[model samples]
Target: MKTPKNQFWNAKYSTLVFSLAGFGFACNLAKMLLLPENTNALVFSLEALAMLFFLALLFVAINCQKQHEKWIKEGKEKSAKNIKTLMDENEDLKKRIAEYELKENEEKRFASYQEKMLRKIFSDGKSATDKEHFLHLLAESFAAGAAVLYKESEPSGQFIVEEVYALPEDFIPQPFVLGEGFHGQAAQDLSPIVVSSIDADMIPVASGLGNTSTGWLYCLPVVKEGRCVYLIEMVTFKEVEIDKMWNEISTRLVDMKIF
Candidate 1:
């Protein structure tokens, strides 16, 4: 396809060639009328000039046509490149969307698993409950091995350790008085406590005799009817998605016991 610019130049060159030819013809006729005795020079000179003009114009027209073809070819190539770039970008966007949806689905599935575990723990109200079995279920859910449950008592305000799932053999189960350590503080304030990393020499993993957890510890207080009723603790080796664990799992600890 020829561009508008190429077509305009073609027309302009053709017009100039025709105008030159007409002017030469008019000059030849004038010369013939003025000197009929020596008309040979006028005829020969005008014919030669007109022939040269036509040859030059023909060469220019051919060159212009070639240039026009080149312009059309270049335009097509540029369009093809742009189309390829756009297709690549679209594929990248689609891959990103697919990854996001997959992540969302996995999160929902894990949250569902956490909820089901809670429901199972409280399945039979009065049935004989096994604290160890319940803790094992919790550990499996979190991909961790250790678990603990605490019960907060009245007036004296002590948090007694009710269950220990996978503590080390040397570790002892004990109680925590209010304001003693982070665990005690969590009980007193009725809030959740998360230690991303534990330093054994500095903080006590167990309250009574003081044991180092040696890993991450999560302490959550379960409040009921304006009083803190329970404190659930767990120390795990792997890093967890803290916000998701807190939001989806910890909140369900209310009214739940190790039994």
Candidate 2:
């Protein structure tokens, strides 16, 4: 259970001590051989035995040092693996939390939008067929820079702009058949359409100061009695999650139909 650092120091200390002891024994044996008068048979035999003992101790210390080094290597590799595993788990947890928070925020936005629409439709007793009022309200609720509501002509089967909110005075609405363009496609399919990366000249909002270009355009269809009667187009500088609220609005509008 020794730490790598402690094991390293212990191995080094043992090697040093055993090496010094072995070297000292060898020196003594050499000295005894030089002084032949003092080198008796019995004394030489004892000195040789002592030298062998030190050599054995040195060998054991060297082997123990190698074992300690192996243990340290294994410990470092295991520690590194554990650290990597923890880091991967932490990254995964962060991703999950971010996804959950994004979903929660979208739900909150949808709830607030629905609540405001309900108040305008029922609490204020505003007629659902009032295209101008609803167009402005929808644009304000979704924070759009500009909005336009298109109504389908009953006889001609073409969609034409009926109401506009925050558009330039010089701006004109283009009329199109059900399958002609993005606005028409949403009405034809009875579904929402999203257009992105629009240029500044495409949908421009004029103010007293200047004109600002919108980047995103959303086309939402209004269904009544199994048919699309209106297509609302709104533009904003940035994208918003307005698509999810379509289902709720469609349901309420269908329920409140005059036919």
Candidate 3:
């Protein structure tokens, strides 16, 4: 019970053996017909053996040629697969590099905007007492719907709204203590507070057109001599670069004696 592979090899070997034996027999018959009087068996055997050796060498050469061709074809296919893998890797690397460059450019533009904002707001030669002008500047800079400037009242020791910008005339600002609401909390912590995606139920911001729920709110406290001197609240209908604005303000606020 030979397997298919064993059967194939057996068939091939049988064919080669039969072909060699048939050639030897044919040669002997031809020699007998050509030289009837000189019947030398040794000469016939030598000629037959030489012919079989030549045929075996030819078969060996042909088999080696086929094996060489098979090796070449396999090597070419493997090389092609390797080349395709390398090309795919190169494309992936290109995408990653492109993403990194885009992110770097965005960061650069954000930094530039922050730098300009710092120069415009802190170096305007306007005193902190000019609360209205300051609020107007901030509202315009951030595209804010409304803005409120609160200053620490020397008499009451409470944060009181000093100025308002772009808000309705009827809207009144309520004063608060150090730990009261968002503005007071920012002042208490000496940090900035950001609120995003406000609900309609919360306090609505009133503009010249009408009252609407603000999308974003920012509360920033200006500190001087280890105490919060002012708190600024900005409301916008769209998101702004609040972190960049805060960074610029905090870095430069310490230098200005705005108290």
Best by lDDT: 3
Say which prediction, candidate 1 or candidate 3, comes out ahead on TM-score.
Answer: 3
Candidate 1 vs 3: which has more lDDT:
3
Model 2: pairs clashing at backbone N, Cα or C within 3 Å: none
Per-prediction tally of clashes: 1, 0, 0
**Any idea what lDDT model 3 has?**
0.74
* RMSD in order of candidates: 8.4, 5.9, 9.5
Sort order, TM-score high to low: 2, 3, 1
Q: Report how far off residue 153 is in candidate 1 (Å).
A: 9.0
lDDT of each: 0.67, 0.73, 0.74
Please state the error at residue 13 of candidate 2 in Å: 4.8
- Displacement of residue 123 (Cα, Å) in model 2 is 3.2
Q: Which 10 residues in a row give candidate 1 its minimum summed lDDT?
A: 250-259
Pick the TM-score winner: 2
Q: Write the per-residue lDDT of candidate 2 for residues 24-90, one digit (tens) a residue.
A: 8778878777867855788878877877887787788778878877987898999999999999999
Candidate 3 per-residue C-alpha lDDT over 19-116 given as tens digits, one digit per residue, 9 for 90 to 100: 87678667866765687567688876787787778678767866875786588669878988999999999999999999999999999998888888
Steric clash pairs (candidate 3)? none
TM-score against truth, every candidate: 0.53, 0.64, 0.58
Off by over 4 Å in 2: 1-5, 20-61, 91-95, 102-106, 139-147, 153-157, 160-172, 196-215, 224-227, 236-241
> Model 3 — TM-score against the truth?
0.58
